[model samples]
Target: MRAPGKLVPVVLLVLALVGCTNMPPPPLVTTPPSKPPPTKPAKTSEVVIGVDGITGGYNPHTVADQSAVTTALGALLLPSVFRPAADGTPQMDRTLMRSATVTKYQPYTVTYELRGDASWSDGPPIAAEDFLYLWEQMRRAPGVIDSAGYRLIDNITARDAGKVVEVTFDKPYPGWRSLFNGLLPAHLLKDAPGGWDAALEDGFPATGGPFAVSRLDQERGEIQLERNERYWEQPAALEKVVFRRADQVGVVDALRRGNDQLALLRTDSVGLSLLGTLGNTVAVHTVPRSATATVLLRPVGEDMSDARVRRAISALLDRDALVATGTRGGPGSTLRAEAQVLSPTAPGYRPTRPGGVSSGQPELAQAEAALQQAGYTRGAGIWMRDGRPLSLVIAAPAERESYVSMARELQRQLVNAGIQAKVETPSADQLFTESLASVPTGQRTTGAVHLAVVPRPVGGDPATVLASNFGCLQGESAVAGAQPTNPVGFCDASVQPTIEAALSGAVPVAETLTTIEPVLWREALTVPLFQEADSLAVRPELTGVDVGRAPSGPFDTAVAWRRAPN
Candidate 1:
């Protein structure tokens, strides 16, 4: 989901002004090839950014169509009530919202006040109806992507003639801040026939943020955003921003050629060797992203269904070695050996490596012993039980090249320990979208996917990720049904109370996470591999660049960016 496109209305206005000019035309000017007429110094205030690619349609709610580009665009153009700070704390964007307060605890209720001056670029007030519309779509629309926290809200109503919003919940929700981060204009979406899909696709709507989409060229894979005149806050520092599509090599080339000032590249996308070559030409910043690469064992009918088997697999793999190999031993490469879902950098996070699991040092003997105790014998360099080999299939998303390398490494380690394992690299759509749902009771499992190497972003609230991924009553638990984030079908009734307690603000977050971390480790639901660091190349003069926990990249704080003294 990237930003949508149309020619800027301002372009026409400039043309009309030129046509009505009364001054005599100036004489043509020319310069020799050796000394070209001083090209009116390219706007120093604007920033040109290069991204991986423009793949999905520009709709974040359209689950399957969302992409990193879409999330980035939303940060720039959409109306967000709260924006995450560098430390992953929610900061109220006073331009869009005045305040949000919890007025009641039991049958939880919240009151929100929107800025009186905040209105969409098209002249509609940013009101409670917009929040209500987003909530209704997320709760009712089947195609909507992530509705975890939104579904908890019971109702929302307008007060003070649409200036204030009052929301009531059926149960306590501590992660309320995560909801309604990006709100669509109600006037445009509420009455649309196709609902959100139609509204999001019918040209990006006029926005209320610091910037608005001025042009989107799909063929050239570029999007241009101009400062929003209707913005209620201090104006954005840059007058215009252009996002261009580029691969790893292209990103480096664009930066070197002075065509782009900023670019984000994955370590795997551009090898460490290539990054090192840039040297003094560009400054590399290792931004600690919230996402972590993990290995999820399917809890359905397979040898991996047994906790012992899963734990044994966890013990055998050398996560440090995997990270080293996958990242090419880069400067920021390190293993996320903690069994918990929270990133080490996140608040309330604690290291919890399961007692027996060897992260950097492989415990092949212990792994084999566990397999033997489970009624398996080594034969022909593979474990066999009752004339059947202990075979498993690991699925990796093809788009993430590092995951592919890690999957192969995992397969090799398993085979070395007398286990038959195979790695299958599938398209991102197939691995993330198609294979996320649980297999029906009487239906055949798709591809018999035994394990999946996936990445989950642990945003500002670690509790949100914990609840969304591991809670018994939510996510992809057998009881809660399947969701894309929780396809492993991990369910423990005992952990539900703690999860609910933490989410409802009844228990201390650290205490709840401390209680739940052990459960995840004991069940071997997921093997935390590493916290992926977002790599960015920027000109030395650029200032106020910050990579927050959101998936929107560094542009999450684009409004604050400026050029430093040269």
Candidate 2:
């Protein structure tokens, strides 16, 4: 009976619990949903720059291929032992070199210690072989740029498993810092199909700088560079860089439309004025280039064989008018050249002309006298010498409007002076390789023209420039290939000793220039008109567009360029 009562209480408890569960759950309780975390905007990492043109031969060491685009590419893709500082002096690149110091006095030894991590984009170590290759090529190559310092190198020794380089000079070279710039990748270029002449003609085989060539199209005039993943230094700020060829109007339009972020162009006064139209959207600056506008009278030509006739032509030239034509009243107009050996804007440049010859005005009376002295008689508005008409052909690069304009002006001036002359516009490559380069020994190729309005490369080592311009090819038995030296085909044996002295560092550069400039001018072979200038125009969204150094301009610090948020 007691068990039955307990079971009844248990059954009642169970029934009460079941009844509570059966009733609807008391008021569903929940917290409000939170808003999703706000997303952030992506940062920009690409930049597009406008350039005048894109010629595929990108070797910075060659006279024929030396241009703004070449310099820019070299700064982005090549490595150098020393780079130019803002003061225009050699400063060792800390990213590539740990230390570079003079170790010996007697043999004049210089020891360079490369950073252990420094390497080419393709994973090859930047070692002594690269230095050796550049030295061998520069000292021996016919058309290389500024090989004087390389020639002084007697031998190179490698140590520390190729991480250390020891250079032994035959004599003390104070300008040794100028050597080994834009070091090429020996592993790829040494045995390439075309050798030094054809090396980098298409694009770099390997890159040693912060950026590498991702795309290079010659016909389309576009070269795209991307951040080099193998670079050991700080990564470049921009992920992609594109060099696009465009004219002045196109560049202005692109900048306005945000298609281009920056532009480096060979500009005239009208070009500057057009840039001014952009107002606060862009900033423009004048960047002095390493070349000077010049007029060269090829003595190998029949009409210009006599120095007197050359002098007569020189006397008739209106340099001011030519400068105005070439510069188009731009900043270069203020850089009128006053010397044969150095550009007026170059450091230590001094006028070498006699006092009376300081003014660059047409001396019509002197021109007539010189023509008469040369036994040239005027007949039917043309000079005739030895029963031959004194006619000439003036040449200029077709791509360069300034050069073509200057050539046309010169032709008009010569025609007005009773000297029959015609203008010829040719491609820069053809003009440099065939018309300007020295022909091989025992073989002759008559150039298309006798007079050339060209850009003479300067602002390098004075000795190297002198040798490149006027010195005879010493020790070389024959001109086996195209030699971009002595373009006028005129050399004086008497000045050979002085040139050697300068190249050997025996005579100071200033003294050497002083001694030889007058002789060069008296020869009447070449006349420097003005220093050339390139303008860098930058859009507001693009930052870090500055003249990094004296020679290379903005490309020297291209790794620091960036695109800012609008």
Candidate 3:
């Protein structure tokens, strides 16, 4: 996985609080009117959701402080230029944007026209300055989140006063739509004492969506949002929303006791058998996460660096068995076995078999034959070549229970093929932070891990991820300078051209991916196991519940949720 961006300490504290089972007490819930003497009230409904606590203020641009809770809340209170479709393609939100078009391909340029009626709760119109301010911050700010797309933009200028904005990019970036999904209000943040950090620490200054923050009680682990009457679009169906911090176990308890309406549970934390007990009382929704668990082979060593050896190892392990055991035979158990770096769900994914090598369904006999062809002779139940045992050390993080289980299962499977495999569960910091960096002079030996079980972050475009992991390395950088994601030192110059073409966005995504898929399988750089999916337990009465393709949770479409007719 890629290293996390700089975040505030408070946000980390909140995340830690949410991860542990012993949660803080609920916040003070505002009481309703005792007497019914007021005029007929607007139809009102409230939903209490149990989630991992909201840390890092509500600003989505603050990358370090951003979490699932932060992104979900930002989706409710801010205006997104484009929303992602089910296949991870960006679709323009007609409510906020009148139209968005790419006017030119070279020196890429795009023009956005904002809806005439769109305005902040404080009555400030959404204008070109807002876009300009965000662009400037993303370019100059050190702690801002995901500046890759923004850094490509040369400039953004206002046209026709504040109604339209024209953007020019330094290069042809295909994933431009992924940017500005959570636009911050410039007028409110411009004069903040500590800049964007201090301005957004308390909560949002104003809201453009259907809901606005009514109260934020961090000490009690709660956030309350009420309808935004100033919203320009159709009024929100639900009157109020309450987000309370709870662990996976607490979430199940809250839903069963009728204290909470919905909860998102990690499959690793809550087994499938436990969810089955809920039966028809609650609705379960499986959300696909933009990440995949893979086995990365170190490409530098003489023992395993050879492509034949990697292919043999790939053939020895059963990916379907790993998925089944890791997911505990749940909704995501039957995951599509992947042969290349790109995920099955990613835009440019294509399954290719080079030399008739099967991508899934392990063939132990073929694996043994390949090792024998490589001049390895079996002795004392282990393959040996040039007086060296065919032994491998696989490293995995201790936190993810699923990955640990997969590693153990792989270890057991490899033993049958005369391979001695050792699985090491290291601390997250050691495996992710220290081991990935270049070792210092006179330091202890770098953790020369032969294989690592890790997840790669997948987002709107696979180009960036593909380039970072598989592209050729520029120069000699030892394990000290090595990146954790590419620890195997596998860089193929042959695949660079196709990767560049995909990054340029000039070619059809499907065609580009289809061409690259075979090269990856032929080389056998990494073996992809399965894509990660999240599970949610929602009450049957809540309707219009939709899980977003983006990292945000079900709240992505919170405005559409309504109570079922009794």
Best by lDDT: 2
Model 3 per-residue lDDT tens digits across residues 373-448:
8889899889999998888888777756677888888888788778999999985435653443322222223346
Which parts of model 1 are misplaced by more than 4 Å? 1-36, 57-68, 136-148, 185-206, 268-281, 330-332, 335-337, 422-426, 439-446, 474-485, 547-553, 563-566
| Cα lDDT listed for each candidate | 0.72, 0.82, 0.70
lDDT of 2 at 425: 88
Please give the ranking of all candidate structures by TM-score, highest first, separated by commas. 2, 1, 3
Per-candidate Cα RMSD to the true structure, in Å, reads: 14.0, 9.5, 19.0
Clashes of each: 2, 0, 7
Candidate 3 Cα RMSD after full superposition onto the native fold (Å) = 19.0
Top candidate (TM-score): 2
Worst 10 residues of 3 by lDDT: 437-446
Tens-digit per-residue lDDT, 1-566, candidate 1: 63344456767887888889986677789985786677566667788887776655566655444456677778888888777866668877777788998888776988899889989989989888888888987764543444557767888988887989999997888778877877887887688787665666534767878999898887788888999998888899989888898777787787777788887756563455566687886787676655677777766555766777887787788877777766665433753547566776676667887667675778878887878877888877878888999888888878667778888888888888878888888776566546655443223354677777766556546666666666544532345433333456555555666776777778977887777777778777788777766577787767788756655668777898886533
Please give the range of 10 consecutive residues that has the lowest summed lDDT in model 2: 475-484
lDDT of 1 at 291: 63
Please give the lDDT score for candidate 2. Answer: 0.82
Which scores higher on lDDT, 2 or 3? Answer: 2
